[model samples]
Target chain A: MDTTSYNNPEQGNQEERLWNYIDGTATATEKTLIEKLIESNAEWKEKYRELLEVNQLLQASELEAPSMRFSKNVMEEISRVHIAPATKSYINKKIIWGLGFFFITMFIGFLIYGIGQMTFTGGEESTLTKNISKVDFSKFFNNTWVNAFMMINVVVGLFLLDMFLSNKRKEFRKQA
Target chain B: MSTGLNDNEIISKVLSGDHQAYAIIVNRYQNYVFTLTLRMIKSREDAEEVAQDVFIKAYKYLADFRGASKFTTWLYTIVNNTCITFLRKKRLDIQSLDNEHVFATADNIDSGMRANIVEQKSKLAMVNDAIGLLGSDDAQIITLFYKAEQSLEEIAEILGLETNTAKVRLHRARTRLKEKMETHYTEEVKNIYN
Candidate 1:
């Protein structure tokens, strides 16, 4: 009986260690210890040989290659995802210019509305001192210039609201 | 090997929109991936599909790969999971040695003599059949250890098991395979000598 075998007689219990050994997963220290044991152990040596034979049989087995369309299919799926969206030059350019003009017009209109409201209110408060609450908009509506300005304001407000709503919808769609 | 770019370098290039850099990674590991998938799925069609899925998935998740381990290790983890999922969906039953005794015996003789012209083909088929008999975990352990050449530590990480556990699973799988082989051998010998 080999001395090493006498020391480690239960060879079957080391089957897991043998697998780790074949896989090169054992730590350096553990590997050295196992190696030293194998050197003096006949049973371990025999077990190692049997495992090596199986390993070789497995290695000798040929692996069949996948079909040529494999990579192509993968690329196709990836392309569907990562490929950039089509560039719409006309629509994009139009939207950019339209947004710029819309913002500028809104700014000017806001400034005009602020100034007009301040001036009109400041003058009306003093001019209509006699029961201003009872005063009606009939006279103001009869004045062509006042009515024309009011009508223009309403149209511009509606136009601005339409643009704002449309832009909001576009943003929502983009998020969706 | 010195001149070849490492996986990290290739990954950086890919992230920077060097789309073609992906081919390098694919070429470098395609065979390993193909072999692993083939061994696991056992069907050429399914294996090819799974292998391609693995590559595509690895490509998509490349940015999330934090370099905690080798790229091959990470990739095998994905491949292993993909095959396992496929196997579950297919609901393939484990092949039993008793059920396949006749074919297994013939295959054993064919494999033992190693002399038949179709020995390689038959042996591959037998292994595949035997692998089909094993539980999913055992089959995966056998493939990762023997076919993919993955270390037990790497397999542990992939399978979410302790290193010792992976080793034990591998040992058990091998023991089962050997027993299967032995039974087939005995049957074949009995037939021949009697």
Candidate 2:
């Protein structure tokens, strides 16, 4: 009864449709149609049995095992090579939190020091607050050490930006 | 294989410097990895070598596995690629999945193993031989679907195929396996129906 070549276009279509049904990928209407065909058409019925048997046979086949010493050999091979420690092992959370706390404390201390330097002069009767923009920033900006720090910060920021952009470019290249 | 630890737990232990814990992973997945390698490479010796390379490669890069996908997905991806590389180095025709050279290698393995097991599991033996007759691509897809029990989506991820393409390939692979069974093992297939 299985005389037709599987490569025959019609036969391939039949097999594909039956496979979709077997794999549960077919729509409800297609499923009903296939069921009716299997019930009424001997060809569909035979094809269904063959395909189902193949599915069952595949599921039943045992996975091929390696030699009894396979794992031992792998473990032995691994022993000779150095494996790096896990990520959590090397990174110190305490140091990270300590740096974070120090930065926060320094930021707040600078804000408080700057605010303390501001003087609010007021007359009792008709006073608007003094123009804060007139407060001299030249004293802070003129320190060689401060200027050096700002330059260092700018250079470091640029370096970090370059690193980040390069990494993003590498990721884009990989995806493409 | 069950060291009372799941894959993630084992991975954590291995990462945390319990190098011995990797043995649990090796024991757990060796057969699976070996089977996949064998299906693709078609030689037990080369498959064994490649399977070992796969495990070692996975271990070296285990830290890179981010758990974005199942661990098996990552591991099988390594297996699939390693086999492809092995085939390429040998300069085998990978694109021609139905090549006689590929099928002949499978036949050599199946013919030797099929005899001793025939009395106990003839049906399984027949199916295994029929699968050996299939090209590496078809065999890998079938093994992934049935033996590994991977969903089509996982198969897609492992094979680097679109989900729809994976579905179609799986359908076509099974169809070809059916054709092989019908053509090569008609007697056993008849027995299955009876």
Whole-model Cα lDDT of every candidate shown, in order: 0.67, 0.81
- lDDT per residue (tens digit) for residues A36-55 in model 1: 77788986776776666656
Q: All candidates' TM-scores?
A: 0.56, 0.69
How does residue A156 of candidate 2 score in lDDT?
A: 58
**Candidate 2 local Cα displacement, residue B47, angstroms:** 0.4
- lDDT tens per residue, model 2, A1-176: 25354558888899889988988889999999999999999988988898888888888998989988888888888888876555776789999789757755765565566556555443444434454455566665665655565575678568779889977865664586
- lDDT of candidate 1 over B31-114, digit per residue (tens): 778877766666677888889888888887777776867788899999988877887788865332234644656566656465
- Stretches of candidate 1 off by over 4 Å are A1-11, A17-44, A59-62, A83-176, B1-3, B93-135, B185-194
Which CAPRI quality tier does the interface of model 2 achieve?
acceptable
Which predicted model would earn the best DockQ? 2
Candidate topping TM-score: 2
Interface RMSD of each: 9.0, 2.8
> Lowest-lDDT window of 10 residues in candidate 2 chain A?
A120-129
Candidate maximizing lDDT: 2
